[model samples]
Target: MARPRKPLLSRERIVDTARALVDAEGLAAVSTRRLAAELGVSGPSLYNHFRTKDQILEAVADSVSAQVDLSMFDAADPRDWRTALHDWAVSYRAALTLHPNIVPVLARGPGRRPAGLRLADAVFGAMVAAGWPPAQATSIGALMRYFIMGSALGSFAGGFVDDETAYDPADYPHLGQAHLLAERQDLIDARAFETGLHALLDGLAAQYEHMAGGEGPGRPAGDASTPAEASPGHP
Candidate 1:
């Protein structure tokens, strides 16, 4: 019997390898030639699976988005909405942080991909299910998505200093003091993420309540909380 030849390359394999490459060496290192070399194939072989680096990047982003467990969020409990959002935000931050180099690509173009759109829909659906109107739910969901992506991109680009290194008592006395008190026991990896997510959900909930004819506790009458208000002491 004639021997069967194995498939030379597949889109899944290409995207997986591309993701690993970006995770290891940043997005700059992901090229068809480099990927082919890593996969023990000829450079032109990669074109059979992905026509260009952008396509490969898109594929990689899709793969990553697929890994997000949308079911982890709870849409039934209004009180638990903040916690659910926190979990989702934390998971998203961790995923992007692990591959910081991909943050730019993710921010720039992945928003329209099927997985990305589906994730957005899921978030919006969750919000609506939790009693928010369609427009408010959509706006809040988009706002949270933007916040998470922007924060991750900023963190990847060194816009954010590590909590340990960011504090300087001489220049930032109050911030330094607060950091010291907050991290005295343990410094959580995604404290900022959790804090931001909670603030966003809290603000959204307040808005929803107000729109539904209830006076909310978090914000003043007729004024929504801004991002600055959401992140009171954050830079």
Candidate 2:
């Protein structure tokens, strides 16, 4: 009897391999021939799984989205919303940073992949559970995603020089002084990811509070008493 053959590789396997390759060597390193070689299969075999390189890239993007863990925010804990959002942003930025090759691909929508849609749905759901209206939740989630992705791209670009780049003091005195200060105390150690994430969350939280307050106890226009007027004192 002939030896049993190994099971045929699926598209998931192909995309997983592509993701690993991109994470290790970047987007340019992934191609039909290269991935086939790595998988011990012929280029034609890859065609059976993915029609083209773009298809493989889309799969890889979807795979990355599937990897996101949203279970941490499943509970209705409004108190922990900030921390949860921060953690989520950090995880997202780390994933993008690790696989900078997929950044561009993800910058485009990953189409109707279940994983991609679920990721968006999870974000919006979490925001809604955390006191945002449906419309505001969707908007905030989208805004946060855009901001985080942009920040990741900038971070991947290795933002802001320390003291190495040349600077002209006469023409740009403030910038030159700022650069000097940055180098003197190593202020360049400031993390773009953390700073951007917190700032975005803070702004979002403030907006949510404003919206919620607008809907509470002060229904009619101009009938809501100011804080000072509400107090038991002459105004």
Candidate 3:
């Protein structure tokens, strides 16, 4: 028989199969044997491309990272920090929402993932170039990761049952209408993300102005007194 135009076993096919498994059945669903079966190849064929299942999962996570838009962080003609950060956060959240199963792996920090590293580098570099102290920039990256990942992990609105009777008015007066949220899950989640994003950027903008004017939290922009315990995360 003639050789197939496309190779039967390739790294791309392996990663794609693994990613589809993760997306459909969570990260635990991906294994070499299963991937090989899905790819119609022997299990040993996978080892030729990936040494272990973890490596395959890493490639899948990095593929999702690569989908996030980083153009706003372009050093050549960068957008203002606030605008760029907001766009990046939205893009990041969108990417994670598509592959929430991988968010846990992505949360493990850049490690040795090239695409993930580029993401962290862009956020930190952009913030520093925008005049934020390095520490604050690090905090911003961490904060964004926490927010975006948390949002992707699950839907707050979807958590509630659509049953109107679920909320007992006597004990939960404030949540009387909470049951309605699940019906509008997508709208509520999206608006909630936007509201949170706006609040974060607005707060950061205020702090940036204060720092630039040498009066933020009793320290100037270049001052090293700001609380900066947080470090950047992977996604």
> Can you write out model 2's per-residue Cα lDDT over 55-156, one digit (the tens) per residue?
899889877776666665777544366777777776776677667678787877546667777777767777667776555555566676787677656443
- What is the Cα-based lDDT of residue 233 in candidate 3? 38
Q: How well does candidate 2 match the true structure in TM-score terms?
A: 0.75
The per-candidate count of clashes, in order, stands at 0, 0, 0
User: Which pairs clash in model 2?
Assistant: none
Model 1's lDDT to the true fold? 0.66
- Candidate that scores best on lDDT: 3
Candidate 1's TM-score reads: 0.72
Give the alpha carbon lDDT tens digit for every residue of 1-235 in model 1. 9899988788878888899998888888988889988899999888877789988998788777766667755444443555666777777776776666777776664455777666776776676566655555555665776887776764322333436557777887766434344433223435566667778777766665676676533334564655443311100
Badly placed stretches (over 4 Å) of model 1 are 73-83, 109-112, 154-189, 214-235
Comparison by TM-score, 2 against 3, better one: 3
Candidate 3 residue lDDT tens string, 140-210: 88889898888998999999998888889898989988988989998999999999999988888888888
lDDT score for candidate 2 against the true structure:
0.68
Q: Against the unseen true structure, what C-alpha lDDT does each candidate score?
A: 0.66, 0.68, 0.85
Clashing pairs in 1: none
**Stretches > 4 Å off in candidate 3:** 1-5, 216-235
**TM-score, per-candidate, Cα-based:** 0.72, 0.75, 0.89
